[model samples]
Every structure is written in structure tokens, then in C-alpha cells.
Target chain A: MTDDTDDIKGTPALDPVISDSVELRLARQIRELDREMMPERDLWTAIERNIADYPQRKPFNLQGDWMPYGVAASLIIAIAALLVNVVGLEQRNSTLLAADYAIDSIDSGYVNVRNPMVDQFRETNKNLDQATLDDLYRNIEIMAQARKDIEMQVRANPENTKLVEMLMRVHERELELLKQDYSQPGRSL
Target chain B: MNRALKATLSGVLLAFVWAMPCYAAVDSGDLAGKRVDLSEAAKPDGFVKISIVRGDLIVEGWDKDEVSLVGTLDEKTEQFIFDVSGRDTRIIVKIPSNNTSWCCNEGSNLRIMVPKGSQVDVATVSTEVRLTDIRGGLDMSGVSGDVRIQKVSERLRVRNVSGEITVHDVDAYARIKTVSGEIDARSIKGGGAFHTVSGEIVLRDVTDEIDVESVSGDIEVIGRNISLARGHSVSGDIDLEIELIDDALVEFDSVSGSVRLRLDGKLNHKFDLETGSGSIRNRITDDKPKKSKYIRDEQLRFTVGEGDGQVNVSTRSGDISVSK
Candidate 1:
């Protein structure tokens, strides 16, 4: 296993080559640095032995000690992108936690301000023809299921801003649907 | 046993059994259609209202200052109300409010001709409303009925529960919404907003602005000259092939759905694209996506040309494809 995993292979990246402005800036900064002085001690063989135990974990293909600053800048940009979308619906978290939590704190703070007529439509409104009524119910169920499935996806990818935005959009759809009496047409829509 | 009496009783029983199905048929299906034909004078820029249960409505606009309604209502229809007051006209066909699926078949077939500039409003349960050559505005809503309309030159608003809506040749602001029904429109010469759930949306050559939202439905837009666009979906893919103006604001968001943006003409927008658990493939500009060392997310932030406008696209578990 150690011999097979010694040369950690890199999978073909699905994205375009990572050469954005920040990366270019960081690359320029890296080029300006001089060769680092030798450390007091080096434990390359011990690190290799420890890596043999966990052959599944692949190290990030990053070079130089300045990589941490680059990562921080990227994280800042990502968070800014997220804040542009779900500021009202999302609960603000000061720090990013470990990946151990199954669901995000935003899920608890997010409440779907349902349409007041949703319960009425689910319970009453028998005057509608069967086909239309059935379609309505099926759609309601579909929307409910869609909401659930999206919440599950949010739980899985807590750092995904698009998923959170998608969840809020589903809630907005629910609100729009609730404000309607499907049996009647809007004279002034 | 009395043989004559027993024979007579058996014949009566058989006759009663045979007649039961005929009575049931008469109660349900065999209904005569009630005909309605009426014409009233009205203003050119007046108001017209129509209501029906279910059927095909063929409504058009004429140059004359009159509203003519000709149709056959269901025999089970309780009332046919056609009234014209001043410049307003109302045509309503009423039936028993509580009805089963087998209540009406091929419902009312109405052909209405209104004035050229009449703002018409229609409501129905399961009726396919078709409007054509109406120079004014149209506001209509229904449930489970497909809508087909054309040649409107004003604000057009349509809402449906589970029916497909198709619009052709509109020259004003339009807002069309549906649930579980596909929306297909073309040649819109103004700002347009279309929304649906579990239905695909397609638009072509719509100019001023475009806003679309969907769930579990794909959105494909090919516009000639677009200034602003906003599209959001969950589990629905979005494909936009557009030519933007100088100041364009394009934003797209999705979860578990891919977004493909193909641009044409001179570029002057900043691109802020990201994807989680997915990859961003940028082919339009020299700026490439930057991958995060922590998670499976990539971000591409760059300016194309002078960057006069903004273009943001994000997806979770979905790919982002940008091409020129």
C-alpha cells in the first residue's frame, strides 16, 4: 500500500486552470521571495512514515509558506459573495467551524413565512375540479419535497452560498403560491 | 307457483335494470349545449371581463368599437351573464360550483371579438384562453388550462396553476407565472418576468430585461439585446445566450443545476462566478477560476474589457460554463 500510494496522483481538475487575479498576485509575491534558509531540524523520513498510515488523504498541491495568506484572501472573497445573497435569511456566524455539524445554524434561523392560505388550500377548496385540484396538491407536495431535499443539500454543503440562496428562493415561491386563490382569477394581476 | 304472475314480475325487473344506465348517462354526459351570441357597443380603450369554468376561448380584437361574444356553453351551465355598462363589458358563464371531473366535456367554445384597444381580463378554472391581436393589455388567470396569446402591445399579465403559457409578439411589459407548466414565449419587445415551478422556460429575442425563476425546470434564453437578467432555480439548469447592452446586470443562482452563459458582442462586465462541489469552466476571458484549498469550491473574479456592469453566477453541486 505504501509503495502504491507513494506517488500521490492528482485527478484531472474539472475547473478551468486556477489563475485568477489573487492567484496571480500571490504568484508574483512568491517569485520575489529569496530561497529560504535551512531549518534547524528536518524530519522528512518520519513524515513519510506517518503518511504511509493514511494513504487515502491527499495533500493539497500548494507550495511556499505564503500559501496561507492566499487561502485567507480566497476565503474572504467567498464570504463576501455569500453575504451578497442571504444576509437577511442567514444567521451570521463569526467563525467557520469544523465539518462535524450535520446542518448549518442558518437552517434554524430560517423560517418560511408561509402563505396564510396554504393551510386553507390544503384543507378546503373542494369546489375545484378533480384534475386541477390533484395537480395543485401534487405541486404542493412537489414544492414541499423540493424544500426538504434542498435543506438536506444545505446540510451536506454548509459552505455552499448558492444552496442557501436556493433554499430562500424556494421559500419565496411558497409565499407567492400561498397568496393565491387558485379557484379565482386575478382581475388585476 | 303462479306462472303468469312470476313471468310478468321477471319482465318488469329486466326492464328496470336496462333503463338504469340510460338515466345515468343522461345525468352525466348527454347534455345539450346552450348557445350564446351577443354583441354590444363599447369604447376602443375600454375594459372587458370574462369568466368561464372550462373550455376553449378564442378571443380577438377588431377595429370596430363593439364587443361581440358568440359561444356554446355547457348544458349544465346555470347562468349566462353578458352585460355591458358604459365602456365596460362582462361575459360570465356560471355552472354548479361543485362539480366532478366528468361534469363538463369540451366545455364552452367562445369566440369573442373586442375593440382594438380594450383592456381585457379573463378568469377560468380549466379553460384554454387564446387571445390574439389585442392592442391593449391583457390580464388573465386560470387553473389547469393552457394559455396561448399573440400580438399584444401593452402590459400583459398571466397566471396559471398547471397549464402551459405561450406568448408571441408582445411589445410591452409582461409578467407570466405558472406552476407545473412550461412557459414559451418569443419576440417580446419589453421587459419580461416569467416564473414557474417544475416547468421549463424558454425565451427568444426578448429585449428590455428578463427575469426567470423555476424549480426542477430548465431555462433556456436566447436574447438579441438584453440589459438586465436575473434567473434562479433549484435543480434546474439555466442556459443563456445573450447580447448585452453597455450597462448589464446579470445574476444567476442554482442548486444542483448547471448554468451555461454564452456571450456575444463587445464585453464590458465584471464576472463573479463560483461553484461548490462543482467546477467552473471559463472560456470567454483569460481569467481562470481559483480553487479553494479547503473545500470543493472554485471562484472566478475578473473584469472583461472596461467592466461597466456586473455578472454573477453561482451554483452548488452544479457546473458553471461560460463561453464566448
Candidate 2:
């Protein structure tokens, strides 16, 4: 695809062309180039044939273009709805009985609310055996079950704010278990 | 060489590696077993950590700046160590982690002595612990054993799975936890938190603010004047007989456990007691409880004799009784 001017690079006489101005080089190159390029064979006939053989796109139809867009929009809405239900409904249904003062004492134990020392504990005990890890997880499950029991009681006795406060305390214990340092030789489940 | 001979040698090596116990010290000095008199020189205000799987552990704080371990190793102990490095000391007994026979004789009964100012941390499994006269902070955990503490003047934290925990003359900030073990503390100063599951919690002569949570276990805090006290439980009765300070704040919440408070002072506190399906008995004053118009609940709110302190108690099915 390159022109014969590609050979000018290694020519000794053209070494000085590198120092020439851009306009001068362009003028000289243009003068030396052919006005038109023609193939030995008639390439226009092949071009025409290829052009006629290539398939043409169909006329624009809203059905094909809008279908994917419509599907994408519906998917976005569905996911949004699912997220709202999962998060928002729980917040709505929750009735926390503990006062902010009471909760502040328990919540201050861990700075992280969602994961709380889970990553740190796992990273610290990367060499822990499977059985030890299983024991840790089993204890966590037991605490979680206790918390779940209180939460269920909260649902049944919504009138009793005491139930709600008790649930909060149980939840705090579960968090403490999650935050326990299993890597420390002084660990106790 | 024959392949069979190599296999036998390799099997022996594997057995050795499998039985190797975990033991390490940052900079241990001297071989610590005066099993023959193993003692190590340690800093007075240093740290000591002890771990065992079973047997009795008696730790005492002494004026002498030394850490010593005196005891016989258990029959199944794969490794026994009393390591001291700089200000840190570790006394550990490791048994085979994969042993089939876990019956008795898995750890050692050892008495460890550290400087009075040295912080102590002990972890055990079914090993009874007796700690005394440690002015430094204490952190202890037990799987199933009785833990007794006396004259601990600094902060203390104890956790046990199933055993009796008794603390006497502890004047530090403390937190004691037991899953299925009874806790009895006397003359505890500087308020603390107590937690238990299906075990009784009894605190006598405890001062300062206290937080208690229990599950299916009774909680009793008797003979004290506390500025603040908070308690919560599920199916466990709570009995508090104490005097409230002028600005005291006491709150008790229970699902099915009854809450009874007896004030041993002049009546000068506001009380808010409520129950879903339980009666509220007020004996400090002659105020009749009001019934909730919306639900079948009872509410009693009264202030007596220039009420300066407040008491809030609520329950789902537990009766509330507060008296002076």
C-alpha cells in the first residue's frame, strides 16, 4: 500500500530532506507524485460489482430498535423496585424500642456497622484450619439465631418496646462475636 | 534403595511433622521450665499471656519483678512453654490438636506469678482460673471452668462458656460474660457490665453505673447505691435492691422476666413503669397505675418527694414492682 517514495528513506541523496521545511517537502513530494493512480486491471468494475453484491440495511423499524431499549428500561425499573423493597421495607417494618441513649452504649463498641472486623479477623487468621473457621462460623450462627429469635419476638410484641430493646442488645452481642479476634491465641468463642 | 524403605521413612517424617505443636516467642530468654524451677525475669509493668486447653491455672501478682510457671505438664501435652521476651511473657500448654482421646490430662495445672503491674491475659478450655491482687488490666476467657478473681484493682474482662465466675473485692471497671455459667460478684466498685445466658447473675455492693443483659437467667443486684443501671433480659427475672442517687438513671427492659426494684433511701425519684400484659405494683407512693386506652397494657408514672432521679422499667409479660 506504500508508494515508491518509501524507498527515499535509505537513499543517501535524500538524507538532507529531513532538514527541509514541511512546505518544501510537501511541494517536492507532490510534484514527484502521479496525478492519479490507475490499476493495470479495471478496478472500478470490481468495486461496482462488490458494491452491488453487498447487502443493504433494511428500512428503519421502531420494533427492532425500541425492543431492546424497552427491555433495558423495564429491567432497570425491576431492579430498582427489588432494591427498594429489600431495603426500604425493612426500615419501614422495623420498630426500634431502645432509646438513642441506650443504643449509643452498644453501638460505640465497633466503629464499623455493616462488616465490623470481619475482614480484619479473616485476614489475621488466614492460616486458620477449616475446623477452626467452622467453629467460628458456627458460633456466629448461634448468636445470629439468638438475635433472630429476639427479632421475631419484636414482631409479635410490637407493643412492648422492651422487646425491641432486648433485640438491640442481642444484635450487639452478635456484632461482638463477629468482631472477636480468632487469630489471637487468647480467643474464646 | 527399595521404595518400601523410602515410604516408611517418609511416613515417619510425616508423623513427626503432624505432631509438631505451635510454639514461638518474639525473643524468648532462657529455657522456661523449672519443671525443674522454670522462672524468667520480666518487667514489672510488662504483659503476660497464658493459654491452656485444660487443667487448673492459678495466677497471682507479686511485688517481685519475675514471671514463673510451676506445674507438671499434662499427659497429652505436646508442648509446654513459659516464654519471656523483654516485657512480654507467654506461658502456654499445647496439646495435640488432632488427638482422638480428648478425655482428661490435656493441659497442665500451673501457678504463674507476674509483677503486680503486669497486665494479664489468660485463655483456657475447662481449666479453672484463680487470679488475685493484679492491679493491672486483666483479660480472661474460659470454655468450661470456674474463674475466680479477687482484689483486682484495674480494669478486668472475663468470658466463660459454662462455669461459675466469682469476683470479690474488684474495684475496677469490669465486664464479665458467661454463656451458661453463674456470676457472683461482691464489693465491686467502678461499675461494670455483666452478661449471661441461662445462668444467674448476682452482684452485691456494686457501685457506679452497670449494664446487664441476660437470657433465661435471673439477675440480682443487691445492697448498693448506683448512679446508673441498665438491664435487659428475655425470660429472666431481675431483682434490684439499691438506693438511687439524686441524678440516677435506671432502666430495665424484659420480655417475660419480672423486674423488682427496692430503694433503700428516701423517695425522690420519678418512675415510669409499663407492661403489655402485666400488672405494675408501686409501693413507694399510693399512685394507681393507669391502663392504656389503646391496648390491654398498664402504665404507672409518678414522681415522689421532689423527684430528682428517674426510673424506667418496661416488660411484655413481666410484672414491674418498684418500692422504697
Candidate 3:
């Protein structure tokens, strides 16, 4: 063994040792190692006490959060605004449609009121003279043409109140003519 | 007994004298295309009633204090009866009771001149009746004949079934009705009811209260100082250019025809307008309308000036336009 220990510039050096037999070298290394290592003390009881004193935690849920509530509130406000707008438009449209329906109802009522008068006149004046009857019929034809013309105008303007009133007036006139002719003083119906 | 017998004989003598012809130039010959002049003494303010079956009847006011009939008769017609007694004069072109088959073909054309300020009542079937420059009330009715009256100063009542009625310069109340003939009246100082079935009614310069009703004919009224104007039409357009007097009321009702009202520039009225299924183009006000969400009809209620006059217009389906 060459000398392996050397003192270099005020520092101590260690000698290098080598072993040929594996078991004898391991025994020598084990004998040279320090064996005085110890574990820390056990605090299981204290940890258990601390854990028992602490408060319990609940499971997290997205619905219980403030952000979800804010989003839901905003959604409700938006839907309400949209509903108000829709209702306003619907009301405007319904008003116009209702007016049209009323006009049609009035026209139907006029027809109902005029038909009976016409029928009664025809029944009473069945034996009127040909010339007188022809005169009455010719005049009635003129009235009918006027009515047709008014009706055509009404078709072009369905909402014309004057046209509808004139139509009723025309019907009333026809009835009046029939009634007057049948009720004439000299006429034997 | 003697006194009673004498009284009875006197009564018989009086009856014989009354039965004699009072005025006897009663020409009974053929009067075809010939002027038959007959005059009868009458009071100044007496009444003349004329009846004809089928003929053109013309009555005019003259300065004379007598009633005269001067016109031609149809060749086929035979009898013309003129009776004047006391303050009444009656003229009739008699169609014999056996001649019931005669139409308007056989008739007379009589032009009777009555005293001024006389109440005249004339009736004819299928005869055109014309009355001019009459000072008293006129009551005339015709069937299938046109009636034209001008410058009548009293109440006028004219009725026709299928004949046109034209009245001009009527100073008193005028009531006219026709079934299928046009009624053209102008310069009517007193307003009355004008009704027509299918004939157009044109009224211009009519004053006082007027009521016009038409079934299918257009009504055009250009009235001045109209106190109360009520117009009701079924299907005819009403064109009114009216100047309402103080505290006047004008009401117009229509079913489906448009109404255009041109009010005078000095109109002070409260306008109440309503229309179904028609929009209002109001130039009267610049304010926005108070639209009801439930009722779709257009309504305008506004006051103009002091609102002394009222204008009420209602329509079922027609537009109402009012302008100054």
C-alpha cells in the first residue's frame, strides 16, 4: 500500500482504502458506519383532537353561487322586456282587425233588416199593372245599378264608412219605394 | 100651413138657381194643340187646386185677380172640367171613369195663371208640373213626371215617385221627396227635409235647418248660414261646403261613403268625429291622437275657436275629412 495520506497547504487529508473480498469489505464498511439515528415522537392523539374541533365543510354547487344568481336575474329582466314589446305589437294589430270585423257585422245586419220588407212588398203588389210595374222595376233597376256601383267602391275601400252607410241607405230606399208603390192611394194591389 | 109651403117653394127656387152654370164659356170641343183660355174671377189670396191624370201642368203667378187656364189638350182626350166658385178654383182634365186603361199617352198641357200670393195645390200622374214665381205655399205631387219650381216664396212640398224635382229660389220651407229622380235645389232660404231613394241630391246656397237623407244617391250641399244640417246617407258620398251660423249643429252619418266637409274659414265648432276601419288625416290639430288599444276605430274630438258650433260625424267604414 503506498502512502495515500497527504497534508496540502494547512489542510488534513484522508487515506484511500481498497478491499478484494466482497463480504469482508462490506463487513468492514458496515462496522465503520454510524448507527445512532432515531425517529421523531408520535402526536396522533393531538392531531385527532385538532381534527375533531374543526368545522365541517359542505359540497360545492354551481347553483348556490352568486354569479349564477346574477346571470339568472339578468335573463329574467331581458325576457320580461321582450314580452312587453311583443304584447304591444299584438294589441295594435288586434285593434285594426277588430274594426274590420265590426264593419262586416253592420253590413250583415242591414241585409237582415231589408229582406223582410222587400218580401212583404212583393207579396202585396203581385197584381200591379204591367206599365206601372215596369216603371217601378225600371227605377229599381237604376237603384240596383247605383248599389252595385257603391258596392264596387266599397270593395276597393273596405273601411269606407260613407260607402257602407250609402249601401244601407240604398237598401232602405228600395224598401221605401216598394212600400210606397204598394201603399199608394189609388193602387189596387 | 101656407107659410111652410111658401118656405119650401123658395128653397126649391134657390136650389134651381144654384144648379145653373155660374160662368159658362166652358168650351167642350176638340182642344188638341189649341190654347183654351178660361178666366174666373177670384180673390187675391185665394187657393187654386188642380188635378190631372196625364198631362204637363204649368202654373204661374200673375198680377191679375183672376184664375186662367190657357194650354193645349191631347187630341184623344175629350173632357176638361174647370170649376170656380167662391174663393176656390178647381181645374181637372177628366179621364172618364170608363177609360181606366189610359196611361200617360192621352193628356193635356195646361198653363194656368193664378193670382199672386195664392196657395196652389196640384197633383198629376205622369205629367211634368212646373210652377214659377208663386208667392204662397205650394203642395204638388206627381208620379213618373218631373217637377220644376222656381221663385216660390212660401212653404213648398213636392213628392214624386220616378220624376226629377228641381226647386230654385224657394224662400220658405221646402220639403222634397223622390224615389228614383234627382232633386236639384238651389237658393233655398228655408231648409227642410230632402229625401231620395236612388237619385242624386244637389243643394246649393241653402239656409236655415236642413235634413237630407239619401239611400244610394250622392249628396252635394253647398250651404251658407246653415243652422242645423243633418245628413244621413247609406252609400253615397257627401260633399258639403257649409258655412255654419252661430251655435249651429251639423250631424252627418254614413255607412261606407267618404265625407268631405269644407267648413267656412270663420268656423268655431266642436268636432266629434268617429270612423270604423278608417284612419283620420286630421289637419285641424297638430297634437298626437289618443289611440285606444282595444278599439281600433279612429276618433277625433277637438274644439276649434270658442266651440260655439258642433260638428258630429260618424261613419262605419268611411273616412271623414273636415277642412276650413
lDDT of 2 by residue, B133-240 (tens): 888889988656689999888789998766799999887988998766799999888889999866799999999889988877899997566899999988899999
Residue A110 in candidate 1, Cα distance off native in Å = 10
RMSD of 1: 23.1
TM-score of each: 0.70, 0.65, 0.65
TM-score, B chain alone, candidates in order: 0.88, 0.87, 0.88
List the pairs of residues colliding in candidate 2. B34-B37, B34-B38
- Index of the highest-TM-score prediction: 1
- Model 2 TM-score relative to the real fold: 0.65
Which regions in candidate 1 have their CA more than 4 angstroms from the true location?
A1-119, A122-124, A153-189, B1-32, B101-104
Candidate number that wins on DockQ, 2 or 3: 3
For residue B105, give model 2's deviation from the true position in Å.
Answer: 2.3
Ranked candidates, highest DockQ first = 1, 3, 2
Docking category of candidate 2: incorrect
Clashes of 2: 2
Task: Give the per-residue lDDT digits (tens) of candidate 3, residues B276-315.
Answer: 7766656666644455686768888999889998999877
Q: Where's the lowest-lDDT run of ten residues in candidate 3 chain B?
A: B95-104
